[model samples]
Target: MAGAPIYSKADLARAETYKARDYPANVDPAIETLVREMMSGFADKWTVTILDTLWDSGTLRFSELARQVTGISQKMLTQTLRRMQRDGLVVRTLYPSVPPKVEYTLSPLGMTLGAAFCNVWIWALENHKAVDDARARFDEAE
Candidate 1:
């Protein structure tokens, strides 16, 4: 082909390094379960939102977090926090006071997850206009 790109030997090796991996013939079931659990946490919008909010606003009390997250119900927030705690993403602290105050903060693993998601948030903000334009064109075409 006249316009086809040509790759040097070094370019071919670099491209090979970037290629996707294939699982071995005897794959471990535990690895699959772990990946499934990780994907579920990443797929949940509420989980990501809570993590992002916590990442931005240090440690916050339950009421403060609820307010910051916006649109999250008390019950749903409670559930999400519990699930995050189980996954070792968030830490919950209880103060033995007259009213019994409770606070939440991201754990070390949660901080890492938040850092990874920051890139995604940045990409979304940068590409939102293009995405909206594409959606409009598609809608107009239909």
Candidate 2:
């Protein structure tokens, strides 16, 4: 406890003020629609896994990406990559060679999204045990 950090009352008040700001309720309809569409891309389990894999590995060829993503079917990977490319989250490059190599990398927008999602990953890591415990308790109750 001695080494634990403490927040002053002023710090707590400032944090509360920041948290109380209601930006989402007043968002423009078009902007809300666009945000929902963008967020839906991440609603799929495969999309988040692919993004996380690419974020860590950077510029992987199609086969390498498929392998890294683990359990992802070739068809699903191709479809997800194409959708990501269309959404500007990933850039797909094709080499005009005899073998015709293709590679996928996160676009600038994808990098930004990955950065934002890092906080979510951290939160999950921090709370994973608590979540598992809660689920176990709920199951026991049932």
Candidate 3:
């Protein structure tokens, strides 16, 4: 850890200013905590996939979403949806019926998240070949 690069917030802010991009000099603790929590939640594959599916397909029932998100077990889907709902990333609706009727859609908060993730999709599309080649080289070396 001795040789590890040490960067201060000032340094980061300076770098951002050099690039003419906005950087918060004083980040609020609450906002930082929320960002960390949301990032941790979105780090998983299923959550990201579910977000993408919902973004593309709009409102969908549980079974429909399950089918769209291939390879996710019903239990896993249920758990993921529950987490998303709890996190305010998804909205769930239930209607009275003989059995039951339920649907899921992205909340306003979730739509903002989806928009933010669009930048990630753009980055992946731009750098996928470079990433793939790097992985292949690393595998060969290993």
Candidate 4:
């Protein structure tokens, strides 16, 4: 932990810009319900991983996607892709040829979602050490 990298103060300040300044007194129930549903969907680790991979790699074949997203089983990847496709997050292209060809890419909707979540990735990068130190302290106290 001693050699852990630390982000510059400017970087931290930039990250803070994304935080909500204030909330309206009145909230719409329908909007709150939609937000909750989306949060739960994005909460899946595999879903996030797949989104990041596709965002970086553009279009990728099924097997290649599996290779890029390490630790995801074929079954899990298939299920995650199915859910993503169903939710209009990814565009799956099927080519009719020998053995059949398929590729997955982020739809325009998915790209926007990826952009929205980019802030979360930046936050994690900046605060990972603080999180680790907190965990270490908590563990030692136990």
**Candidate 2 residues 14-98, lDDT tens each?**
7799899876767899998988998888899889999999999999999999989999999999999999999999999999998
User: Which residue segments of model 2 deviate by more than 4 Å?
Assistant: 1-19
Question: Each prediction's Cα lDDT score?
Answer: 0.87, 0.89, 0.90, 0.90
Give model 1's clash tally: 0
User: What tens-digit string does per-residue lDDT give for candidate 3 at 10-93?
Assistant: 757867887896768899999999989988988888999999999999999999999999999999999999999999999999
The list of candidate 4 runs beyond 4 A from truth reads 1-20
Deviation in Å, model 1, residue 38 alpha carbon: 2.6
Candidate 3, residue 98: CA error in Å?
1.4
Ranking by TM-score: 2, 3, 4, 1
Total clashing residue pairs per candidate?
Answer: 0, 0, 0, 0
- As for model 4, its CA RMSD to the true structure in angstroms is 5.1
Model 4: per-residue lDDT, tens digit, 22-126? Answer: 777788999899789878888889999999999999999999999999999999999999999998999999999999999999999999999988988887997
* Cα RMSD, each candidate: 5.8, 6.3, 6.0, 5.1
Find the candidate with the highest TM-score and give its number.
Answer: 2
lDDT of 1 by residue, 5-98 (tens): 4446875776687674574878799998987998887787789889989999989999999999899999999999999999999999999997
